[model samples]
Target: MPNITFHTKHIFSALLLFLVFGIQAFSKDIKQCDLLIQNGIDAMWEKDHVKSLELLTEARTLAEKNHWYKQLFLATNNIGANYYNLLDYGEALNYYLESYTIAVKHLEPKYEMIVLNNIAILYSKKKDFEKANEYFKKAYDIAVENKDEVKIGLYAMNLGNVANETNNLKKARDYFNESLPLLKSNPQFEILAKMAIAENDLLQKNYNQAQVTAETLLKTTKDLNYHDIGISLLMILSKSNFEQNNLDLASDYAQKIFARKPNLETKVAVFKLLSDINQKKMHFDLALQFKDSIIKAERELNEINNGRAFENNRVKFEIENYKKEIALNEAQLSNERKIFYSVLAIIIIVVFFVILTLRNLSVKHKQKKLIAERNEQIISLELEKKKSDNLLLEKMISEKETASLLEHEKLKNEIEQKNRKLSAKALYLSGRNELIEETLQSLSKLPEISNNNLLTNHIQTLKSHLKTDAEWDSFITHFEEVNQTFLNNLKTKHPKLNANDIRFITYIYMNLSTKEISSMLNITAEACRKRKERIANRMELSSEIPLYDYLSTL
Candidate 1:
């Protein structure tokens, strides 16, 4: 070889510098895109749809140029959200589908789930509940596949909301029930699920129950500083009370919403509710005041709606042209590929025929030898087939045994999982009851509550409703149902165990730590351990064997 002395260090330094600079530039671009997206979202919230679209479009362009699928997805999806809020379903659906395409092609499945939800929401706004349910179920399935509890709860809540809209109250309740426990740690979604359940109750004409649920949720949302959720709860309460002919309570809720200075739609609804309430009371003058307010609010709402439609059309045209450009590029690329593949196929065909022709020329001379070899091969194949059949039968028998074992294990795991869920629910309820009790105690000492008989009575009623044992009874009922066989086996083996002992044993069998069991049982950790030891002593088990381990054998 020729003598070649390369400046390897210099080349390496140059490459390293290029890499570092490339990363910096890429990071800078993404930051800029993020800033644009945030500003676009802010603008959308401000109802400046035109400005929002301008910012989002710029971000989308940068994201697309750099192949940043996440940013591109956010920008596109937000634009769709803007259109959605403007009541432009057609434009919204187009942008949503475009984002869905990006998510499906370039991103992880979780991104696709996000787009699926958006598409479902758009269909929901269009009152296409069937299509909406289809997409919502797909998103929920993806959440299940990913083992994402938060999203599972969220999508389940969405599904339930849609079911409520479609008048399928039973199905709605089922979804909500499945969602609530999974969402217990997620206050935002848990509130939404509760709201949906209350809405379902309202739709089913269970007005008193709906009011109670909404009233409880209002307090929860208020404590969490969830202003919008509180407003929604207020609306539910207002509607439920109104349906029950509790005009005074309904008017009070409507006034609360009005005092919050909610959106024009809410304002219109409140104004109408107040007007009806006053009219029902024969206060014509007060009714006329609200009636006039409604007219003014409706006019403003109408003007805004008309303006949004015009602004949306202008933006829609621009977006449509941009899509057409992308489509044209894709069409050109596809056609080029088709031509390349066509030529390659033709070349392959020509080569194949040449090979076939040569093979035919040698066929006669080798035919007799080939036939003699084939006879020997046929005898070998028959022997192999007999061996294969025997092996196949053995494999089938083995697979059947394996399948039965697997099914038994699956059922056991399912019961264990159900018990775990029940345990979680118990813990949640325990914590919630403690918090409620503390709140009542604090309120009882407050001067305002003590001085006011009505407030004190309300507090007393709330205290009466706080039946800690009732919740535990419900939990035990469910736990017993899920772990029926396990419980029966344990009882049969330990007939001397009492109900409380069995409860303790049940907690131990769930593999809960000492602290968790203590909290659930309202006892200290030391006491919980003593109780465990006592139970073991009663069961006549050795000290070396742990309670959980002993229970597991059962």
Candidate 2:
């Protein structure tokens, strides 16, 4: 007993030591993960993108290994930012999407808004204004739903920018106006919104208003040393003055933009404005020089855009491969976990049965004769009990079969009732559509209705509503309840059958006539018959077999 106790104490001590070491190792990994992430962010800020990616990738690996979602989100989002800075928009979008998925699944809505905004910015950079608008609107809606004032202000600023780019000046003004108050705490964003409003005025050809606004912001930018904002204000001032025929002032503002060392896009705009200003001033040589500079800047911009386009397609394929790899890893991990649990359960069950068997074997010798006598009596009782149990089981099974049959019959009746209701609904929709079509035809034949725009629009609206799918959807719901396995069995057997083919097959299954189906589907009877044959051919069924008969068999 002492030896057993000593061995148990040793085992417990080993387990305790292992647990302590495991905890230490886990803490070490967390600390290392955080260190790597912080270092990666520093590298990104320092413009060492390659080093940033390396460190962040290491952190991502560690975070994923330990299921650290927050660290993973940060790492992934920063990786996207790095790619974005490099003009690899496709790769940036891919990582942003990954982080977006992680945020949606494991993090808060605020994180989701961050990734959504990043994705919108990528789309905006790629000149996909429509998609950019969509994502920006989505992020804005989320911010509104969360009542996050900061996010609301930020996203509102973004939406305003998108609206201005798309030439929706009124909408841009509204968004800016909405954001300005909300972003009062954020001076930078407030200035950005004010700048956007100035740009909006310029775009709308309100030259006086634009010049006044830009001049006011120009002083604020100078006072705050906001060089980038100052450059933008200069461009707005240059354009506004040029439009007002203040050529000398425009030239001075454009030249100031050059001194600011603005980005290539801003430089291109400035060069174009300078060229136009020189041309208006009758300085042909100077205009030609500025035009050449514009050409060079535009060529560089095009190269960057083209590079982004190429990377977009390349990264699509890369992301697909990455997804496949992730799926495979998850599958392997799941299989490993299942195997571990299965082995542990088997070990426990085997140990329990072995101990029980050994205990039984140890008692068998002393109780051998008595056990034999008891076994005889037990066998006699078991024989009697088993016979009685068999008889009861037989009776129970008979009763169960009767109950099952009654339940099945009742279920069948219910299904039949649902099918009848579904059929009636389909027929009613068919008749209603037919009636609307007849009314439309009659209306079209009337000269008074055909000549008037209002009447014509009403007729078109009626036609649009005539072929509504809502009733068909309701019918399908009832039909599915009545024939639950039919669609599944049909799909399993005829995998190539499309949705339209399935809908036609469903009508045939419900025993609806061809004319009824045609009216319900807004097609002719001949088309319906052809569709039926086409579906049968797609199913690879023999032409000799009727479609309805084949369906009934299924």
Candidate 3:
């Protein structure tokens, strides 16, 4: 399960708004407390509830008890969120209920939705479907009443999650689809909704659609540097690919998942996928390896559980009781034995048992010697093999080093030549820019070019005169192809997404400022902003994330 995080988007926006308005305003009285609260929230996200509770408790105590409603509410919510992160549903329930009481009494609409939604999440996590749906409905109603567009989708998504958990998949799909239209241009929410939809598709046996959805999400999220979502998307795509019988792609994705440095469950899932792949490949040896992996995973879980399940020295008690049972039986037998003949027969039996034991020991000693001799011979051969392997490895390394040096020298010469070529190409680019400027200078100078085909042909002819003629042309063509592919892919994954939206996300992914993107793309700031806004509208990410953030999300 992915860790749920608080959206500090509100805080970030607050800061941005201050800058935009040139508000050299005084900080709020709760500034320290607010920072502490944020810290507590961050701690909770990292699952450090103890620290979160401590910080929240301090903040609550510092506030005016007489007017403690807001402080109490925030504290309770923070502590409850911490417990929720810790998966302590019972405790989390207690704290959230306290927070909910204050929100209801105070009628703080904003805080009310936050608390209610959190409670709903807790209930959902607990699998209390009835209660989960109840809180979700309440929160949704509040969001509607308050016209809180942001909170609305959260409520809907929460409901979708519950519906999914309860096998109300149709309802889940409906909920996700409903959010889709409302969240069209919002990259972050779209990612979440599509992820849910992708999961739903998988459940419905819509492997192809699910695969496309997951792959698109993986590529987008990976570009955005959203590590958490990227892994999830990759995992989903890997499974989808596996289902589609795209074994090689599935194997590649599975291997990436394996190398992802994941937690236990992720590793287990990856191992299972690999096991499946190997089984299909008829690699019985590798398939069996997953059995061992499963065992190891289970053992790790068991080790954690065993601390509470059994007492130390449990086996010793069982062994001692068994000895007592044997002794009691022997005493009873002694009482039943009545004559000298019985004693003589027992002695004869004991003697035979001892002689047989000795004979067996002698035979085992001879077998041991033979086994040791064989092992010694094997060890000697292995040693020779190891020596041969080391020698071969040394030779390979020497050859590799020699080749690397030669390649390095060759690359140095190529770089020197390429630099000169690129210098000439730069002059050509400058000249082309001048030509284009001159062409636009007068309508009569447009030449015979009427459309893209004419312009492309003109460019081809112009390319033949450049210093790095072929290379420049090739690079330009490749860039055009990649750029077109990027646009098409974005549009395909996001049908409503426009060029502005693509540029916005691209900027975010590139971590470029508006000025920087404008400079690079040779556009004005206003034009760039318009493009980003267009992108935002298309991607459905109008707020909570800016164009840059949205693009970064891609």
Candidate 4:
């Protein structure tokens, strides 16, 4: 094994990270669990799975007690995340679902979005792009609602990756660009920056720029130890060198990939590249041997390994799920036991209270009997003995209090009326928003969004809300109409396209640029561009018109 030494300056940086997390932890209790979860996230970003579990376990333990749904959600998220790093997708997905279930229970939109984003990421990895896109878009909506720039940025990055995988470089660049501005000083963010820049430069065929950015990533990822991305960067760098005919540099990079991964697939590619280099150097024997080795390795790597790991994980997951069910049952039994004990204690307390009350009632009954006996004497002396005048005073006080309460009731009714007015306004706006969505659907059924007078009144009503200065709630109904009418019309025209596909095309033909399309649709620009290109290809456009220009013609 090669002792790959990276730069040693990361110790101080690691300490600084710890200190930052520690300070956040010290500032408050329970409320700062999000900060703890953030630390766990940083650990995951650094590829320190062991540390990730430690922080996340501590964070998850307090989730029920703390209001930090994010912390609890992230604890489950990190567990799956670590499994993902290990390439154990099944376990990762299981944990991801556990987190998602908690988010649903809490009705927390933000963490629910994270679960959705991660699910999309996993599906994409599994080559289920359709499902991946669905999940990613759902997550993007919640992220937008929460104004979480970080999550939006990550969605862009992942969408770019999906674009890159699908051979849509133009779209990939757009998505990467959207993410670049939002990532701050995290190690993972730095790698993503390099990756996005790499995608952009590579798409433009700016080999030098790509090489420089990739090399910078190589330098920074020492303590980060993200070997998978590092190796991919190396592969691209090698490809760039090979394209530029720098065979010596290309050979060095190929060697790095082989050394880092050493898997059969990588070895075959590396061996082929080495063979080419050696043949160029007139080392015929070495080249021929590499070629032979590549053939044998190909057979072993492709046949013996395919689906083997996945099947193993499926079995493991099933077993673990069964165990979890048993544990849950045990927990329920324990809870039942606790409830039984509690009920018993309550019954004992009730019995004690009842005994005391019965004794008091008996004494009261005796006192009442005495009062009954004295009633006749009191009646005889009633005129002379105005000694119980205190009782009359109590009656007068009660009457005065009732009158005061009646006076206050009038003010309460006025406040209730004001609240009712506000609530009515809210319900009106909600109903209008729904109506606009229906209108948008109708508009989309036609070739163009209808500016016809039928909707003129509805749009006017919505605009009136803005005059009342309900900024956030205003314009929502109008946009809903725009979205629905325009989209539904397009779907009617093109029934072959799915809901997502129709939305993708509607935005394009509406003169929305690729970046705007991605942002509005909560997709990566690369995805938007690719989807557009795909639609254009399906329609069989010619080179005489650009894809977007042709889409406008539609």
Choose the strongest candidate by lDDT: 2
**Every model's Cα RMSD, please?**
22.7, 21.7, 32.6, 27.4
Model 2 weakest lDDT span, ten residues long: 312-321
TM-score: which is higher, 2 or 4?
2
User: What lDDT score is found at residue 156 in candidate 2?
Assistant: 89
lDDT for 288 in candidate 2 is 58
List TM-scores for all candidates, in order: 0.50, 0.56, 0.46, 0.45
Count of clashes, each model:
0, 0, 12, 14
Global lDDT of each candidate: 0.78, 0.78, 0.64, 0.64
Candidate number that wins on lDDT, 1 or 4: 1
The 10 consecutive residues of candidate 3 with the worst lDDT sum are 308-317
lDDT of 2 by residue, 245-313 (tens): 999999999898778788888887888789789878866558757766866776676666556545543
Candidate 4 structure lDDT: 0.64
Off by over 4 Å in 4: 1-79, 82-88, 94-98, 101-107, 137-141, 212-224, 227-230, 258-269, 275-288, 291-554
Which 10-residue window in model 4 sums to the lowest lDDT? Answer: 1-10
Off by over 4 Å in 3: 1-39, 42-49, 62-64, 127-130, 222-227, 280-282, 301-554
At residue 186, what lDDT does model 2 achieve?
80
- For model 4, how does the per-residue alpha-carbon lDDT over 312-340 read when each residue is reduced to its tens digit? 34434443444344445544665575556
Report the candidate with higher lDDT, 2 versus 4. 2
Give lDDT for model 3.
Answer: 0.64
Model 1, position 322, has a per-residue lDDT of: 51
lDDT of 1 by residue, 122-156 (tens): 89978899999999999999999999999999999
